[model samples]
Target: MTTTKPRPTGSSGSADDADATYEHHLTADEQKWIDKKKYAWIFSIVPAAIPLIIWGVAEWMKAIDAPVFFAHASWFLGPIAVFILIPIGDFVLGRDGENAPEEFVPQLEETKYYRIVSYLYFPVMLASLILCCWQWKYGGMEWYDKLGLAWSMGMTSGIGIVAAHELGHKKTGFERWLAKIVLAVPAYGHFYVEHNKGHHVKVATPEDPVSSRMGENAYTYLLRSIPRQIPRAWNVEKTRLARSKKGQFNLDNDVWNAWLITIVLWVALVIGFGIGILPYMVIQAVIGIALLEFVNYLEHYGLLRQKLEDGRYERCSPEHSWNSDNLTTNIFLYQLQRHSDHHANPTRRYQSLRSDVFAPELPAGYATMIAAAAMPPVWFAIMDRRLMQYYNYDIERANLHPSKAAKLRKKWNRVAAKQQQTVKAG
Candidate 1:
């Protein structure tokens, strides 16, 4: 319900001023809807900022001769915030149902302020990573503190990837390259190619390894998704190169080149710090990539796009993607919780992404759901029932694990049939 004046199109320093022209056409009510989440998007930087704040606290604690345990505990505030505090914020702040109408998208998209908010994350995140590395090498910190720092960096890098996701989806070459650059922090630069080329195209279908299968646990998912995504991304670039008769051995291959950035970054950090810094880097990369996968797993779990008579999978609709509108997660993630609209318009700016209330909605925002996904029994206990209801107990419609398909189909199809019979009798 909060409101602000409708910013003149291109007034916020958008580069393409000619396209938008210096004008405002929206009525007062429409302007209010557009501005509701405008400032909220700035919170996307909080994840990237957490490490720097933690570093400052640790430094302050040291200066004060604070208890060693208190100093060490500060390192864990990053994970505590991501996994614990953010979820609580979702419950407390509740859902955001605003969807700026289609007429407003062009002006909303041209608002450069939103992009600038995301643009801040990279430098802040890199500074945080560098500081964390320095502490690991030169601060004489204990092993537990280093371990905590690694997880903290991982959590930040994981959120950095979310910013990268926003950047990667833009039509501009600059944003795309920024996505690759940010992804290098977690050694996950391949995500740039695979996510845009592979996952988006194959999402919610059986062929997509990145899209979690109905019965797959997060632990097993790491084995399935990680091994497959790298090669798939490579192949996508390779196929593109092949069309022009260029081989993948050269730097023209995006996957190899992007990874080279990762190699150079890690090597530079190792050379500057000690070789001992390598293990913490590895730890952060593992946890960072795991965090990214956890989000991927829940985004499209159990949703299957039906195949047409022509044998092509039906186009991905809102029905195929899970949506959540918890205000806290929405703001921190650039409204990524409004995922159905994202899949529909992949290159749409985050501030303009719409909510589809009728789409299959996650029971809670991704912050809470990802924690549930980490525990298989908990994930299934929460999501399976909702997924069944989405498909109206027709397990045949779900994107199920091959191993569990028969058993699930037998049980759920019977329930569906019983419901049909009861409806007929009524």
Candidate 2:
């Protein structure tokens, strides 16, 4: 058997040699090159805030009675640009595919800039929601325009989940509180409870509602995940409270705190904007939550960790989730597509998460894939084949939903027969 080599401590080796020995994967030269790069680009990620600005612009354009194209089209800007243009841009601009050097890793992780960005998202998200409400209550517009305002605002609200996701993973009191504040916008505070304690524990298995199985369409998955998530979150929080000897409805139950926040916000908005604002609030919450679940579907579609004889599943690895390193998309999403690394090390800060070469790659950014998932046929055509490839064409190895297994088996047989015919003809 091969023995593992000892890693050098900072003192044991020459400066160059120490750098080489420290990283498990990178070469000495690669380490040196990456360490020399400046951390300034981390600040450039601020431009990812543009969608919030665009939402404001969309509302302002309508308020001013701008040209029909400018006014009507403004609502579509966030969705179209994020889903369509950014994916095309990823194709054209391509990926850098660089992971920071181990020597510089500590520096990157220790920086306050990353935390500041997460904090900053809270205000921007709050501002977007306020703007939407103000326009709905005061600004005169058609019902369709109001709907457009909700839809545009909903896109940003969905992104608040991202902020909440990052902050939810933190252990600090302030970060956790910040997560609840952002989550209240979409009325999805339960995610903070479920995602951390529930999804992370059962991801990639049939037990996980958040993890989509083969042949389950996005709509079906959303229908399942959204309802299941709340109960799962409640159970998780209930269990925690029991272990700690705390009451479930008490402030110690973080879910209860977040739920209270959500309810208060909803009541305040309803009181201020009248019963008419109720539908807008509901619609935006549904859209935001649906967008999040759709993302959950894309992240771990058809992947599974094998259950052991003892009943525990195999430890999560990089291969369990799909990854993408599209430069612009990664920046926009706060490197969330470095999902493999995130699952493998849940507490790692988003800025410090690295792309693992072994993880299965997504063909496009999550935004683009989510757009495609809206059409069942297009989603199946793209993802089914990738699922097949991931499992080496073995249907049995894929985590297929029970109801859809027979249908998937028939489809697999047809594809196999077609391939056989091609071979025989050749």
Model 1, position 237: C-alpha lDDT score? 95
- Tens digits of per-residue lDDT, candidate 2, 150-233, equal 776677777778868988998898999989988998899989989999999999899999999988999999888888999999
Task: Give the candidate number with the greatest TM-score.
Answer: 1
List runs of model 2 lying over 4 Å from the truth: 1-66, 413-426
Model 2: how far residue 24 lies from native, Å? 4.8
* lDDT value, residue 135 of candidate 1: 90
Clashing pairs in 2: none
Computed on alpha carbons, the lDDT of every model, listed in order, comes to 0.86, 0.77
Write candidate 1's Cα lDDT for 1-426 as tens digits. 232332221112333332343344566787555377777777889898887888888889989999978988998888998999999999999998877866778888998898899899999899998998899988888899889889999999998899999999888988888888899999999999999999999998999998888888888878988999989999999999999999987788889988998889889988899799999999988889888889988998988877989999966777778889999999898888888889878999998888875578898989899988988999998988899888778787889999888887887888888999999999
Candidate 1, residue 112: CA error in Å?
1.2
lDDT of 2 at 276: 72
On a 0 to 100 scale, what is the lDDT of residue 347 in model 2? 82
Candidate 2, poorest ten consecutive residues by summed lDDT: 3-12
